[model samples]
Target: MDQEKPKSSALSEKSGVEQPEIVSKIAAGHIVALRNKNVAAADLISGILSGNITALSRAITLVESTNPEHLAKANEVINGCLPHANQSIRIGITGVPGVGKSTFIEAFGKHLTGIGKKVAVLAVDPSSTISHGSILGDKTRMEELVKDQNAFIRPSPSGETLGGVARKTRETITLCEAFGFDTIVIETVGVGQSETAVHSMVDFFLLLKISGAGDELQGIKRGIMEMADAIVINKADGDNIKKARLAKTEFNRALHLFPAKKSGWTPKVSTCSAITKDGIDEVWEMISEFLELTKSNHYFGEKRREQNQYWMLETIDERLKNHFYNDKNTIALLEQNKKAVQNNEISPFAAAQILLENYFKFNH
Candidate 1:
């Protein structure tokens, strides 16, 4: 073959002519359009109600933003979308660290999507104090689910919220529901008061347990067990199957001793293997039965109404707290009062009363 002629480079030394001018121009136009696009609250609401995932994600980000303007817009978006929500099943999943929460969620989420159900997972990851940033590593853990087109996974920071949940988790759930996800799963930080906080927001609370030494159950608190609608023992395959079954029995006995739920639905216990994907359908079936019973008895709507009222009050309390604490004068007064109390110059009650009086005086 003849020797190949010298090929010209995209950047020609003869002249400053760009070879990919058209492609570069088109890319620049796209960047300009994206930068200039202003999404309005009404558009966000409409898009969310129409099952637009991008719009839903944007709305959720607004809700999580600490900026005052974003919060106002987020509230507007939420209010507009409220009428179109409440169709999804909100499930809260919690367990101790190493209980395989991510693995279980991956398996469960994939199963739901396989059956043609849209799934949204709101994962709350632990926050790092030094960086004030979240690990947000759940996406890495749930590799398969991350690839599922029908599934949406969002990992939020726990921040200073004692419950191991993002402050705007309920708002995120609302957006997910409006986006037409039929199943919304919230995975909380596996420690602290997360179970109770999750319990208040979700329709069904599923506690994941694993068989360990005789003290396997000791890690979980009694209040959390009482709040669980269903407790599922995980890692039930192979040699662990027998232990999981025994744990299931013990949990069942424990649940029976609690007072009956207001929904008149008794809690149940089951065994599952996220690795083997066994008994996952049975767990979902149990949830469906509970839903049917609650719906028939009208407790389903009743519980939602209660949750709304609870959240409304919570919002008001949080607003008041933020208002008080964000005031510069309030901070100065608090510091002064704290020092006085520490120095034995004033009683804690007196210091608190003075600060409250000052706070109200300025705020009012």
Candidate 2:
């Protein structure tokens, strides 16, 4: 045996057995189906109206897509869903980082669902400037609310828009309303221009703040304070309770300095412990009172009408900007002009004018 070593097996030799044709056929069929599965706009509308979460998610994804092919279908779905929308309360929540926004929203959303209301939370996650990706971890943070059948949580990335609010958030709200969700909660990425954007789209705006973080009055943006329908002081537990109350008082005083809101309702300040779930009910009560007052005074409807008009104009501006910036010639010229301006070969205004003239010549 040693002398006559067995013939070495060749590594390149093919096996005698072959894979079944049926298996390959099935896989090919699946691939074909997947490749051809373009959901119709009417189907998406019907599914959304029937409260299908999967369809709603797909429709929202379509709305958020930047692909030129999706625009028409997205618009069709949105138009179909429009008639069923504007029936839910749109609440926008914003806070600085570490303000317990996710925790508070989880508790508040659960409370809404517990009271027989279908709740939809559209939480905007901040995108990384380097990678242009978002963590999208709200579902993981709101463990309980994510598990609730009556509650829907959709986390969207805040793209390169002026505010950190998602560009398609308003459209997402419409789809949620058509899905039979009576309560819509929008959580902004963080405090900034985001508050203004979210405030315009929501029926009520709540600003969350933590106690003992810094001077309550110092570094606070007057615009945010004025835009808030309520300022909620979070983490109001343990040794922080007294500090939270003081902050609330300060906010209430600051709110008084601003002129009365057009809504004819005064902004309220409250403190709540997201950990202990303390004062969460009172927060809802405050919002309820606001809704009652606004509806009775007809400010609610008027505000919504004004918002619709604002969004229409904003859409036009956004489209024009996109068209100009996305053109190949414009992109090339912009880079050249940028370099020229940086090198002092041309003035900034002159570079801008050249780029604008070129863009208009091609576009017009």
Candidate 3:
């Protein structure tokens, strides 16, 4: 009888009444507020000018978007931000995959912020050929910098081509500058055409290398080395210190072989251990010297003017290319010609010419 009494449940039976909404009203209100948030150009411009990181990030996303409407709004935001931009130092850093570009940038960025400078790092991650997607893992790699209040780190996919990626990055730099970041660092995807793209946008170009990573001079690309304002030998601590100094000497000699840069400043080569934070200050001092020389000689402003002109022409070219490719008729013709060329029924050049003519005619 006691066992039977114990079997009776103390819990209440289920009610037939319907339950209230699972989400709390406060949370629902917050979500609705975010959804209905005003992202107008004027509001974004105001927020960006006041150093609102969220606004700056949203504006950058708008710039990177492919939507025509978003692009128009992005242009408006850029135009508004232009008056406040060009007041910051834009630095570009490039290196091979294993040269520790992310680590170097994180260390350098933290140093800049420590000196009371607001720093922004724009890291470009290479897109996969098959998936056309990027890992965008720079934020994860730069753990400390990402947590720094004075630092901002943004990693973007290196789109279909370096040109597209560079364009977006340049715009992002303007937004960051307008947001009061005095130091803007653009890290390229790798040591290739991306170096040139980044070089054209930044005031200072830095090339990072490591010692004993094969001959210091063997895999070096001439164009990249020429564009470099400074060659930094990273990973220079531990057993790598001596080798790094020797590599620096080799790079210094190699740098001398190239004609003097038009800026009239010799490219400096130095070694640093990103892990140990050794010689990082010298890197910034070197950059400061370059700035003093360039600014005093008026080359800094002149170079910026030239870059503006170059980007203007590039924008025109990109717009025309997009116009041609996005045309419905051109897309159709392109598909047909692609198949024809594959079948050897038509030469690639001829097919390209036919597509171009069709595009022009249709546009006219």
Best by TM-score: 3
Q: How well does model 3 score by local distance difference test? A: 0.88
Candidate 1 lDDT at 4 equals 96
Per-residue accuracy of model 1 over 1-364 as CA lDDT, tens digit each: 8999999996666667545655587789997896468789999999888878778888888899877778878999988877778999999999888899999999999989989999999999998878888879999999999999999999999988867789999998888888888999999898868887888899999999998656855834578878889999999999999989988888877776788999999999999999999989898999999999999999999999999999899889888888888888799889888999999999999998998999888878
Q: What TM-score do all the candidates reach, one by one?
A: 0.87, 0.89, 0.90
Candidate 3 lDDT over residue span 45-111, tens digit each: 9999998888898899889887776878999999999999989999988888899999999999999
Per-residue C-alpha lDDT of model 2 across residues 39-155, encoded as one tens digit per residue: 999999999999888899989999999997899999999999999998999999998888999999999998888888899999999998999999999999999999999999999
- What 10-residue stretch in candidate 1 is worst by lDDT? 14-23
Q: In model 2, what are the clashing residue pairs, if there are any?
A: none
**TM-score, candidate number 3:** 0.90
Best-performing candidate as measured by lDDT: 2
Give the better candidate number (1 or 3) by TM-score.
3
- After superposing candidate 2 on the true structure, give the runs of residues whose Cα lies further than 4 Å from its correct spot: 1-36
Candidate 2 lDDT at 106 equals 94
What's model 1's lDDT at 236? 95
Local distance difference test, each candidate: 0.88, 0.91, 0.88
Assess the local accuracy of residue 80 in candidate 3 as a C-alpha lDDT between 0 and 100.
Answer: 99
